[model samples]
Target: MANHLDLEEQEQLDQFKHFWKQYGNAITWVLIAVLGSFAAWNGYQWWSKRQAEQASAMYEEVERLIGTGDLVASTRAFDDMKQRFPSVFYTQQSGLNLAKAAYLSGKPDVAKTALTWVAGSKADTGLAALAKVRHAGLLIESKEFDEAGKLLSTDFPSEFGGLVADKRGDLALSQGKSDDAAQRFNEALKLLPQQDQYRRLVEVKLAALGSTEAK
Candidate 1:
């Protein structure tokens, strides 16, 4: 009986060895790939967290400068944020804020540069649409009618359609096309939500057109 048991144990060991010899290398490589991917994912998470934290701190500084009414300092801080954290949400936000501040400070050139950057950037689509609308308005103010028209002609997100229509009205009005301006303003009013305050402004513009036919 002892010899029989010994032979059975030997047979089991031989089968295990044969299985290992066939699949050992494949199993090892599979484990290595899975472990490598897990480690890479963990490293990426840590790196992204660190980047956001640093970007948030820099953005706070930019906001603080802006709050103090120091346009120059705010602009510099925004530049720094752009350089260091260009892909961050804060950088995109700073671009918008900086454009407004620059415009209010009588720096139309600076405002245009910032607005152009934001409009053309890979930021959120909605934010980019907002930038394009505001940039078009500035161009219209400068009497760059053709350029403003081109910008407004680009496809905007659905929520921005009303705003884009309003800008087109402004463009037409600038070109002294009162009939076309009234039509565009009516289109804008129709697209805008009834409760939107901007709809009231569009209504005011339509009223100013004096036709009373545009709804």
Candidate 2:
């Protein structure tokens, strides 16, 4: 009976050894891959959080400078934000703020430069379209008529299509295309939703151009 029990134990031990020999490497590799992936994901989240926190703090600084009406300092801070955190939301906001200050301070060229960058950047498409519209307006004011027309011609997001049409009207008028301007203004009026407050402004533009809605 003792001999039979010893043989049973040896058989069990041999089975375990066979399993290890067949699957041990595969199991070990699977565990290593899972652990490595988990660590990589955790590291990425930590880095993203750190970047957002740092960007938020810098945006606050830019906002404070803007509140003080320090256009020069605000410009510097905005430039720094653009350089250090170019892909972040705060950088785009800072660019817009700085453009406003520059334009209000009678620096139209500077305002146009900043706005043009935002418009052409790989930032959110909606905001980029808004920048393009504003930049076109500034160009019109500067009498860069042809360039303004080109800016207005670029495709924008759907929500801004009406706004783009309205700006195109302005550009057409500047180019002495009053008939074309009237047509664009009429199109803008129709594109705007009934409840949109901005629709009234477009109506006024149409009226100024001596155009009425289609009967």
Candidate 3:
């Protein structure tokens, strides 16, 4: 009985060896691929988390600089944010906010610079359209009518139809085309929701045009 048991054990060992010889390389490669992919995924998760954390901290600093009313410093910080964290949401947000603050603070040049950056790259579709609109407004302020016309003519999301029409009206008005401006503002009124506060502003523009049709 002892000898029989030994023979059975040896036969099982031999079978295992044969299986290993047939499939060992294939199993080893499969395991390596799976482990390598898992490691890469984990590493990417860690790296993304670290990048977001750093970007959030920098955005806070940009906000602090803006609050201090030091636009020069704020612009510098925003530039740094854009350079280092271009893919981060905070970078685009900071650029938009900084541009608005700078424009309101009587620094249109700085606003234009920031707007140019945001509009040029187009990170988010909606935001990029907004940047172009505001940038076009600034160009109108500078009486660069042709350039503003070009910017405003680009494709915008469907939701931004009213805004684009309003800007087109403004551009037309700036060029002393009251008839065209009135037509554009009328188009804006149609595109805008009845309850939208912006419709009121467009109404004002129409009224100012003294177009009896608007009444």
Candidate 4:
């Protein structure tokens, strides 16, 4: 009876060994791949967090420099922020700040340059459209009416369509294209909500052009 029990135990051990021999390599590889992927995902999450923290600190420095009216320092900080975190919200915000600072510092060309980059960047479509509108206005200030019109003609976010139309009207008026200006002003009026405060301003513009809203 002891020998019979021993033989049964040996048979069970042999079965386990056979199963291991058949599946051990595949199981080992699967576990290795899964663990490797998990490690990579965790490492990426940590790296992204660290990058965001550093970028936030630098962006704070940019704000401080801007508050102090140090254009050079602000510009430098903005450059650093853009270089390090171009996809971050702060990077796009810094572009706006840089444009405003350049304009206030009597550098219209620099302001236009910054705005143009923001306008054309693929970071955020909404921000890009707004930047294009502002950049167009700056071009108008430079007496580049045709260029301004071209910029305005470029597509924008739907929400900005009214504002862009109004700016185009202004550019047309400045160019002495009265008929074109009236057409654009009409389009802008249609886009503005009836109860909007700015709608009254558009009405005034239409009145000035000897045109009245229909219906």
TM-score-based ranking:
1, 2, 3, 4
Clashing pairs in 2: none
Candidate 4 Cα errors over 4 Å, as ranges:
1-41, 193-200
The number of the candidate with the highest TM-score is: 1
lDDT of each: 0.88, 0.85, 0.89, 0.83
Q: Candidate 1 clashing pairs?
A: none
Predicted model with the maximum lDDT:
3
- TM-score of model 3 vs. true structure: 0.82
Clashes of each: 0, 0, 0, 0
User: Model 1: which ten-residue window has the lowest total lDDT?
Assistant: 206-215
* Residue-wise C-alpha lDDT for candidate 1, range 114-170, written one tens digit per residue: 888788777578778999999999999999998998999898999998999999999
**Model 3, span 46-113: residue lDDT tens:** 98888889989999999999999999899999989988988766777788899999999999999999
Q: Write the per-residue lDDT of candidate 2 for residues 1-215, one digit (tens) a residue.
A: 99999999999999989998999999999999999999999998998788889989999998999899888898888888888877777677777877898899899887887898788677577778888999999999889998998888788888887898889988888888999999988888878787889888888877887889632
Q: Residue 88 deviation, candidate 3, in Å?
A: 1.1
- Number of clashing residue pairs, candidate 3: 0
